[model samples]
Every structure is written in C-alpha cells, then in structure tokens.
Target: MKLNVEQRKIVELEPQGHLAVKGVAGSGKTSVAIRRVSFLKEHYCFEPDDRILLVTYNKTLLNFIHYQFNQLSEEETYDSFLSEHKTDVTITTIDKLMYRSFKARMTRLGLQLKTMTNRRQLLKVMNHALYDMKDNYKDVTILSPKFQNFLLDEIHWLKACDIQDLNVYQEIDRIGRATGSKGMPQKLHKNSETREAIFALKEHYDRLMLKEQWVDFPTINLMALREVEEHPPEGYTHIIIDESQDLTKVQLMYITHVQTDKPHQSIMFVADNTQSIYHLSWLGKGRAYTTIGFDMSGRARTLSKNYRTTTEISKAAYGLIEHDEAILSNVDFVKPALIDRHGHAPIYRFFKDHSSHLVFLKQEIESLIGEYQYKDICIVAKESRFLEDIEQYLLSEKNSSPSTQSSKTRF
Candidate 1:
C-alpha cells in the first residue's frame, strides 16, 4: 500500500503547498486523493476524525467512492486501517460541502437564516416572479413568446429530474399551461444547447433572488465566497479540489481567493482540461472555461498506467479517444501502456447502410453472448433514448432484465 512513483512524487512535490494533479480518464486521480489523505494523516500526525472534504459534481460518483473506501473499511481489505483511523476522514459532494460552508458563514454575510432546497421550488418562484411582473421578468425567464411551449416542456423535464414534490410539479404545470401565462423572453431560443443556459439562468436567478429577498444556489456561492474571504472556516488545514475540470468560472474565482487568503495551507487542484464538461459556462465575457494548466506537479503528479482494463480494451478505448483530434485537443496526458488482455481481438465495424448496420450490430451482440459467454454485457448508448429498442430486442431474446434508465429492461 506504499505510494507508487507518481503518487510519491505528488506527495513529495506538495505535502503542504499549492498542488494540482491533471490526467486523463482512469488515471487514478481518486486513488491519488485517497492515498493523499492517508499520507497526510501519518505525516501530519493528525487525528483520524478530523474532517477532509472530497468534492465531486456528481452524486453517483460520490456514492461509488464511498463504496470504494467502505470496502477498505470492511473486513476483507483494510479493515484494521479503518478501525484505527475511521474517525479521521470524511467525503462529501461539493454541493453539500458548499451548503455546509454557507450555513457556517451565513451570519457573517448579513443573513439571519440560511436555508437549502431543491431546484423545483426555485423554478416555481422564478415563474411567479415572471407572472407578477407581467412577463417582463427583466428578460430573465420569459426569453421569448415563441418558445413558451418549449419552456413549459423544459420545465416538465426539469421537474422529471426533480420529482421529489408532485405538488410543485402540478402547480408549475398548471400555471405554465394557463393561456394567460406571462413573462416570456423575446430573445431566447428553445433548443438542446439551450438546456445548460436555462439551468445557468436558474443559477443566476438564484443569485439575484437575494437582492429582492429571494435566494438560491448561485446566491449561496456568491455570498459564501465573500464570507469565507472575510472569515475563514476553522479546523480545516488544507483544500484539495477534485473534478476541477467541471467547475464554473465563478466557482474557480471563489476558490482562488480561498486559496490565497489561507497562508501555509495546502491547496491542491486536480482536473483534466479535456474533460472540461462545463466549458460553455466559461464563454464570451469570461476566459474561465479554457482553464490555464496549473502545473502544480511543481507537486503536480500523475499515475497514468491504468491497471483497470486489459491491453486490448485499453487499446480499443484509446483508439476511440486518442486519434480523434477534437477530443485530444483538450488533453495532455500519456496514453496508457496497453497491457496483455488474454489475446482477445476487438472487432469493429462501420456500415454504409442503416439496415445492414442494425443487422450487423445484433449479430455481433449475439456472437459475443452466445459464442463467448459474456453475461455482463452493458450496451451504453450516448443518446439514452437509443437504448429503448435495443433493450426490447434483448429482453425478447430470452431472460434480459427490464430496467433501463429510459424504460425497463431486465438482463
């Protein structure tokens, strides 16, 4: 369990200073971060229960990480380490972390009370504001009259993502469907690309909410960042931000001040520019998306040798990603050294005809499952909706499960 070369370099480079780890997918950033806490615990001689925040954008990922460590904390693996040091560490999503930070600092920011809620309520509040203002909305929600129907549909989609309260969804639907629904924007277009922008506007609305005595997520962040600058959080010694590629411009700006204000505090940022998922949020006025590489391997380090997939799988994955210049433009990490993968040859096919393509695809799937006994086959489609038909066929093929994200498929 001693550190690997890359992990050791990362530790040696910045045990207590500004550091950043950048690498491609499956490059072991999580392992590095986990090992980082373990290393620091021993080196700093810190108590096991002291809190260290591990933040990520996705809750699903957070759950997996907790599962990963829980295994270590269990009897089969590093149970002894968990027994002796279980009290020392903590991991949580960035949103929760930010909310916690905001709660602690709310009083400092002239707030009497800090509250947290989901997105559904915020949308309703925004819609209400638009209604009361008679659709002017200062050009906020009512982006245009032409796209009001689209807006309602998008609202439904948002509701789907936030289904905790059917009452709110029903209310929003009722209000949105009312022929007299008001405050439509004149400029916004309803399209797939506009989805993120809509969510961001919701974020922006959250920020402006406080000015009019209404508040939300972006508002919490805006004020919280300022509050932290004025009054730093106590107890926490270092800050390491993961999935930094997914951070928004405002979030980065917030982190910058937090890092500089705390002296002798280690600030480690690990991000992959190629995986900058929120790149559009950095467009136009701000040069935030093209986050300049912070070569903190100055404590910046990497463990690029992926020990996950075999040589063939790694090569196939690499072939799909590396040769494509567009995806490659954002990454600056080494391709994993292809390892031996049991002499399996990955067959790829390209079809000029759609009918032939479907036939060929089914044939391949049948060949793999029938000829190779590959029972755990997961066909991940980019457009989630595409899996519906495939799922049906697979289920009809015999004993597949019906539990797809779109529809149900038992496999």
Candidate 2:
C-alpha cells in the first residue's frame, strides 16, 4: 500500500519482518499506525478479516488505540456497509487477547470456572464452619452475598502474597487465560484441624463452572504462549508491539515464540522507555539482545518528539529520575503542558526545636482549616515513625483541649 512519508516507512520499510517503533509522546505514532492499517487494507493486500491483533501493554493504551481507530474511520468516511461487512480486526489489551486463547485450551483440561470463583470457595469454607457448629446442614446457597464477597477478596489478597491457597481449582482454571509459566498447584492443607475441615468442604466448589473448562488470568498467558511456541500463528505477517518497556522477560519470550516460524513478515515494537519504569533484571552488565536472542527482519526506529509536555515541566521531571542516560536518552513528545505544575516552588520547612514546631503546626492548622475555611489540608510525612510521633502529639493536644474538634485532626 502507498503511504505518506512516515506511514510508508513504518509499514513498507526494508527487511520488514518486525517493526520496532520507539515513539515519544507527541510523535504522531498513532496517526502513522492508522494510515498504515488503512493503506494495508486499501492497497497492501491484507485480507479484510485476517487475525490482525493490536495488543497494548495496558488497558489505558488499548482504549486510546480504539478511540484512534474510531476517529480515523470517521475522518476517512468509508461506506457504512463496507465498514460493517469488513473482516473484524481484533484490538485489545494483551491480557484480554491471551485470555481468549487460553480459555479455549483450558476447556479440554477438565476444570470448571465460576463467575465469583474465589468467593464460592470461601462460602464452602464458611458452610463447613456452619456445618461444624450446626451438625445438620440444610443447604449451601443460603450464605450472605456480602460475607462471601469479603472472603473471596481476602483470598485474592492472600493468593497474591502466596500466604495460602486462596483460589479454588475453578479459580486456577480461569487463570489459564494469561501467557506465562504455568505455576504449580497449591497443596490443600491447613494449620489447624478446623481450617483443614473448611478446606475440604471448599475443594468441591471447583466443579461449578463446567466439568472441564475453567481458567484464570495467569494461566491464560501461560497456555497461549506455550501454544504459539509449539505452533506459531499461521501466515503471521507482522507483529506491532506497544508499551514494550513495561513487558516482562517472560512476556517478551512469548512474543519471540510467536515470531519464530514466521520470521520473514515484520516486527514492530513501539514503546516509550521513559514511561514504564520497571526494575532492570541485569544488575550492572548491560542486557544483550543476542543473549535473549532477537533476530530482526526490520529496522528498529527511534522516534523523538516532545508532543505533550512543556520545556519547563520536562526539564524539572527529568531531574527526578536516575538512569543510565545512554540507554534511556530519547526526546519526549509529551511532557507536562501546564505552567508550573506539581508544586514547582514547594515550601520547605525545617525546625530544630520540637516545642516551637508543635506550636506553629497547631496555629497553622487552626488558621488554615478553621479560620480560613479551608475544607481540607494535608501534611505529608514519608516515614511511619514520623507519622506516629505526629499522631501521638495530635492526640495529646486534642485531649488537653476538649473544646477543639478532635475528629478534625487526621494524620
């Protein structure tokens, strides 16, 4: 397809197997993408309904792309019939994409998934507790919704921390939706006899969704990635990745797996290195592309533009970050736009005398919130130790002054 200067290079550039787009905030990358897609449909000769999946690192970006697509279509003003009849292009967050693929395979794995999977497990445990107390149980469906949701949320928190087997088999079944390493199943046991008894009651709740089709968020990625590694997507021509910086090592491995068989098509990786701040796995030695092994079919384009932010805000924000400037040097397209944002000239207070500080704080609070009619004022202390001292002092002051509104002071 014929494209304008920018779109032509992104879609039709030489050695074009994968397109790696390194775009800054204001680089018009989205405009380029829309033009590229439209060109492909109009002239590049892609089937209307080819499995062209547009995946984003997060939901927010996914939404942005969806909005972009809508706006572009509107501007182009394609016939309503052609637009409706065209083969649908799938645009979604990576998680949702993996979820679709994983859910399919998980159905064959003999697991059931329920809507409120975690809560159901918790209810079974509660039921077991009730059984122990009442001796004669009437039914399982009589539990309160509020209590069940609470137990399920509690299970989710603990599961995240790996403290206990929070989700049931069905919950894990639903987890087959993500692309990553398939985690080991939890051993069903408890600290006390009663807890064990509760667990036994809850274990059967796994067979609720379907006899063999349950899946979960993490498992979805694990299975989908595995499938691609075993048998890559058929006729997979190109891969365009957004939010590349936020993607994990495992996630990258999965993408690599997808491109292995069809290494000739193209790979497009678009990312803002400054946006997604994650811990670098390598301590000091730099990360090598060959070590992880990336064979490129296309050039990795580096885009630099300050589209969103003003020079002043960008200058100030850049100072706060610590990184190797060589690896991360890129012109920002979007920087903070408003004048003097984020309290540029912040008030700095230092008091060596404790009594004097307390006196000043009390007077300041009273004047700002009470006399000045300020609805809310906050004093932020980073550490817990400092907050604790402030809390104690506030309590002592309020106790001494019974006339003051004790509820007004919130540390």
Candidate 3:
C-alpha cells in the first residue's frame, strides 16, 4: 500500500516527546504507526532493548496488527531483522499489555493475581459474591436479578475511573454511566440499599479474588495503572496506542506512567473518536478526554481523507453519526470532508422471520460467490444467537453439497 500525503507525514514524523493523531477509519493510522516504528528502529538508532510497544483496542485488532507486521516483514531483509530483534517490538492489546505488566510486578507487590478468562467465570464470581452478600448482609432483594449486569457494569465503570474505595465510588458524581433503552442515564442511586449491596458485593468480590488468586478484566487495567504510577516504567523507546479514544482513565494513567517527561522517549496515540464504540461500555457516560494522560502538549494531527469507503457510504455514515456531539468534539470539531474512494453502496435486506433471513442470506452468499471470494463476503448478525443459527445453516449447506464438487463454498 502506497502512503498518501497525510500518511507519509505521519510515517516520517520525527521522534519527538509525543505525537497525537486523530484518524478516521480509512486513514491508515495502523500503517502509519507501524511505519513510524520501523523508521525509529532504522533511523533513530533505537536498540533492540528499547521496546517499541504497539497497543491496540482488542485481541482481534492485535491479531490484525500481527498479520500486517508479518506481511511487512515477509521480505528476507526485514524477516531476518525482525527475527533477530524480535523482542525489540511488542504488539498486543491493552488488556494483554496491562496483564503482563501486572503479572511482572505481582510477586514484588505481594498481590496474588488471577484473571477471569471468560464471561461465564466472571458471572460465576459475581453470583458467588452476591450469594455471600445475601447470606451475610441484609437481604437486599430490592436489587432485581436483571440488575446483575447493570451492577457489574457499574463496578467496571468505577474501577475504570480508579474508584476502588466505597466512599469514593458513592460520592463520585456521574459514575460514567451508559444510557438505558429509554434514553435516560443509568446511574446508581445514592445512599440506597442497592448501593450498599453493590458495595458489599465489591468487597466480597475483592475478597473472593484474593482468595481465588484472580482478578476481573477491568480491574487488570486499574492494577496496571496503580503499579505503573507507583513505579514509572523505563526502557521502552516508543509507545504506539491505537484506538486510543476508547481508553479509560486508568489506561491513560498507565500511558502517563510509561511515557516519561524526557524528550528521548516517544508516545504516539492513533484514534478516531467517531469510532469509539467502547464508551458504550458505560452506557454513554465515558467520552474521550482531551488531556489524555498527564499532558496535552503532544502535536495534534488529523487524517481527513477516508480511503476505504465510497463517497456515498461515507456521506451516509456521517449523516447518521453527525448528531453525536462527542464524536464531533473528539474527532474533528468541524466535520472534515472525507474523500472516500468510490465503491458499491451498502445493501440492506429485511426478512420477515429467521428462516426467511437464512434463506436470503444463503442465496446472497451463493450469488456473490461468483464474483467475490468467500473471504470477501461477510454476514453480520446483531446477536450471538443469530450468529450461531447462521453458522449452523452455513455448515449444513456445505455438508449437503455434493462430494464431487471441485470447490467448496465457505462462509
């Protein structure tokens, strides 16, 4: 992929104290970040020990980064270079990076750390804590069973904000809440039995965590932040943060601790606030803070032209999201015109029922398979149940196909 004018500038950026880049979806922020790392290693005389940490939003994005890195380093010269200096660069999701940091300091900090691997485990812990509360504390059956998820979400929000203490959690206004279906802010009631129950559960959860030697996901970020703040990390030459708009305060704090005030070290943040769906974690309470971390002196830059979507698609998207003030403020104050590369308009199909939906989907898949490869087509489901059903249908379709067929159609 050839670097566009904006992307080239980012790739060729001088290794300053920090660089803050706001890029739209198609602006090649990842490519720029990767190229910048390569440039620093090749030009700035950065040693293999000076780790270039590339942190992204999630594991899927981390995999994408790894794939891109692999593709870039496939050449003999770069392959040998990356092979020899493997540890020189670290590409991972923020959670993985934080967990690594927390794990490294766990023994020294005298903290028995255990991370919950899945939602089932997390729910189990929450239920056990709730049961303990019910058995010990006043039976606050006022808190409905459905509120279990909301309570857990609130806990995560508090932890993300570094509000571990019960008093602080109660006093903190706003609580970084997400909106309910009624478009009302979902918040914890002050001085209510519900609040008390939640507090007790938090305590129980912590006790259980310590007892079981385990920690939840969001708590990992909080722990990492605490560790980094107490002991400022050293040795990293540069940090490239992707999808930074979705970062919580704790994650920002970790970044703050890692990146020193010195000019030699570099911190780069690549994000599009418009694409920040993670804020929905708190029911719309969280927004991308301008002064991410300790300072805002980082050179601010924007990538305006979107290279991925068609002009019509871009316009449609913009129209849909333009009403969001948070996106407008964090991304581009004055909605920048995206110079989208022309392509097919997005297709929307509606079905009366699940069976009809699957029939339409299968037919569409068969139709599109003639022009585009299986990898080129994607069927998006709104929920996991729908996805499971679709997957089973696709599997059955493949299984029923004739064995004599030379090529197999894949989903």
Candidate 4:
C-alpha cells in the first residue's frame, strides 16, 4: 500500500521527543507505526545496545502485529535494514512485558506468584471478600449486586491509576464517578462512610488474594511500575505504543521509566480515544497524554480518513455513539471521514429470547455461506458463552451442520 501524506510524515518523524497519532478506525494508524519503525532503522544510526520496543494491549493484537512486522521485514527494500535491526525491535503485550520484567525479581524475593486466570474463580473470590466485609461493617448495602459490581470496578480503577495513598484517593477529584439514576450509587471519594467501607473492602480483597496465593494482572502491573521507578531499565532508544488509549496510568508510568537515558530517545503513542475499549471508566474523562508527561501540543496528529470500513458501516457505528457525552468529551475524538466505498447498511435486530436470536443467526450464516466462503464469515458476541451457545445450536441442527461443510466457520 502506498503511504498517504499524513502517514509519510509520521513515518519520517525525527527520533527525538514524543509523537501522538490519534486516528479513527481504518485510518492506518498501525501501518504508520510499523513504517515508522522501519524508517527509524533505515534513517538513523543506533548504538549497539540501543533497542526499540513496540507494545500493545493484548495477545491477539500482539500476534497480529508480529505477523505484520514480519511481512514488512520480508520486503526487498528493507533487506539491509532488516539485517541490522532484526533483534533490536521487540514486540510484546504490556502484560507479558511486565511479567517478564518483574518475574525474576519476584522469585528472588521468595514471592510465589500465581496469576488467577479463571474469571469465574476471581469473581467468586471477590464476592467472598465483599461478603466478609459486609459481616464486619454490618452494612447490608454492601451485598447489593450493583454495589458489589461498583466496588470491583472502583478497585480496578484505584490500582490502574496507582492511587496507593488512601488519603490521596479520598481527596482526588472523581472524574467518571457520577451519581444519579445512571451512575454509581456510592461515591468513594465523596461520602466518607462509603469511602471508608470501599477502602476496607479493598484491603479485605487484598488479604483474600494473599491467602489464596493469587495475583491479578493489575497487581503485577503495579508491582512492575514500582520496580521500574526504582530500577529504570536501560538501552531502549525508541518505544511505539499501539492502541495507547487502553493503557492505564501505571502502564504509562512504567513505559516512561523504562526508556533509555540517551539524548535521542523517542516514544510514539498511536491511539484513538473513541476506539478505547479497555479501562473506559478507569481513565475517566481526563486527558491522559498530558497527565502522563506527554506534551502533545504541536506534536499530535489526527487521521480523519477511514480506509478500511465502508461509508455505511462507519456511519452506523458513529450513529450509536454520536450523542454519547463520554465520547464527545474525549480530547482526541475525531469524526471519521468515510471513504468512497459503499456497502450494505447495517441491520439492527431485537430478539425476545436467546432461541430466536440463535435461529436468526443460523439463518443468516446459512444464507451468507452460498455467496461468501465460511472463512470470510464471522459471528461476534460480547461474551464467549453466547458464542458457544450459538455454535452448539448451529451444530445440533439436522442436515444443516456448518461444520460438515467447512471448518473455517468462526464464532
């Protein structure tokens, strides 16, 4: 693909300060980030020890990026650059990076670290801790499902923001914690009684985790942040963070401290605030770039033209969040300009029950299978259980088993 003027500018950016590229979906932000890495290797001379790090949020994205980088490296134009910078660029997810950085230190300290992988198990443990708190505080409201859920979210927000001092958390302005029919009932920073109860619940939860010898991702992230602060990692000349909006305050802090002390070190953050799917409430409505020591001012760039999605799809997606206050308040939010391509308008269906929904989904898949290959069709659900249910229902259908035709059908 040929580079656009905007992408070329980002690719050729001088390797010296921070550069933030806020682009809409299908705006080729990831491509620009990859090209920038190639540009740096081809254009600049690096010390033998200097390295580049490209970090993402999850394993799926990490694997996709690795594939893309490998493809780019295979180009004949980059052959010489590949030979020199093959091992210099490290691509990894934030969780894996933190775990690797902290694992040795944790083992040396005689800490038996066991990460809780099962979601149901973690929730059960959390609920047990919450019930224990309720018994001690004599607050029946703590047992309310809504309150319990709010408490869990609040605890995550506290850890993600690295709010260690209880006093600071109590005094800090709660950005996303609003109170009304739509918001959380208890404000941890506002009501003293509520705040105290929540803090106690947090402490209790920590104790339960310790007792079970279980460590969650956020705890590992916090530990890594502290470790990075005390013992800053060296020899990283450049860092490119993709999907940066999903990063927590502590993660950003870790990135800042891990970069090398060399004069020409650079960091690029590519993100779309509107596309931020992780840590939605935790980041609140605050401008993360400035708060985390990035001076975007003139260094920021926005990509408005969306190349991947059709106009119909883009408009439909935008319509859902066009009036959303949270989305509108985002500092990096951009109304994407649609490309020339046009596609079928998105259909929104309302089903009374799961059976009807599954029936409709099966019909749609069977209909589409004639025109498009099974590998090209995908079914998405908010939860894996729903997808599993759909898969089973489809497979159980008499004389209409999609698995019999092709193994590529995906959920």
Error of 3 at 104 (Å): 2.3
Residue range 1-411, candidate 3, lDDT tens digits: 457787888888788777778767777878788777777777764443566777887888877766677667424344565786687766678777787778867866787766686876777777777766666546565343455666676666667777667776566565335455433335556665566667767777778877978888777777777777777767477788887777777776676676534456788878776665564232123343453533444477878777777788888878877887655554333254657367777666777888999888877777776688777787676568899999888777765644213355544
lDDT of 2 by residue, 1-411 (tens): 123465457654543455556665655565555455554444433443343445567888777766666555334633442365255444557666665555555565554453333645546644544444343333322233333433333333222222235333323222111222223223323343433333433333333323444443333455666666665654334456666656644455566665433333445566655565443221012232343456433355655544456655455555555354534443322222333334344344789887777777766766665445424666667566766776677667876654345455344
lDDT of 2: 0.48
| Candidate 1 per-residue C-alpha lDDT over 161-213 given as tens digits, one digit per residue, 9 for 90 to 100 | 23233333333322112334344433333332333345544444444455556
Candidate whose lDDT is highest: 4
lDDT (C-alpha) at residue 141 in model 2: 28
**lDDT (C-alpha) at residue 244 in model 3:** 77
Off by over 4 Å in 2: 1-15, 46-51, 73-88, 113-216, 231-235, 256-264, 278-292, 296-298, 322-411
1 against 2, candidate with superior TM-score: 1
- As for candidate 3, its clashing pairs are 114-214, 114-215, 178-282, 178-283, 178-284, 179-283
How many pairs in model 2 have backbone atoms within 3 A of each other, for residues 3 or more apart or on separate chains, i.e. clashes?
47
TM-score for candidate 4, please give it. 0.87
The runs of at least 3 residues in candidate 3 whose Cα sits more than 4 Å from the true structure, single-residue gaps closed, are 42-51, 69-77, 80-88, 109-113, 135-142, 171-178, 182-186, 189-196, 279-298, 329-336, 351-355, 370-376, 392-411
Error of 4 at 133 (Å): 2.2
Q: How high is the lDDT of residue 218 in model 1?
A: 56
Clash count, one per candidate: 26, 47, 6, 0
lDDT by residue (tens digit), candidate 4, 1-411: 467898898789787689888889989898888787777765664677778888888899877766665666345344455566678877789888888767855865778878876767767777888766666666535444456556777777788888877777777777656663344564544546666667777778878997978877778888887777776766478889988888888888888887887777889988887866565323335466778887788888888899998999999999999999878877778889888999899999999999999989878877777788777878889877898898888777734665445554444
All candidates' lDDT scores? Answer: 0.53, 0.48, 0.68, 0.76
Question: What residue pairs clash in candidate 4, if any at all?
Answer: none
- Among all candidates shown, the one with the greatest TM-score: 4
C-alpha RMSD of candidate 2: 12.5
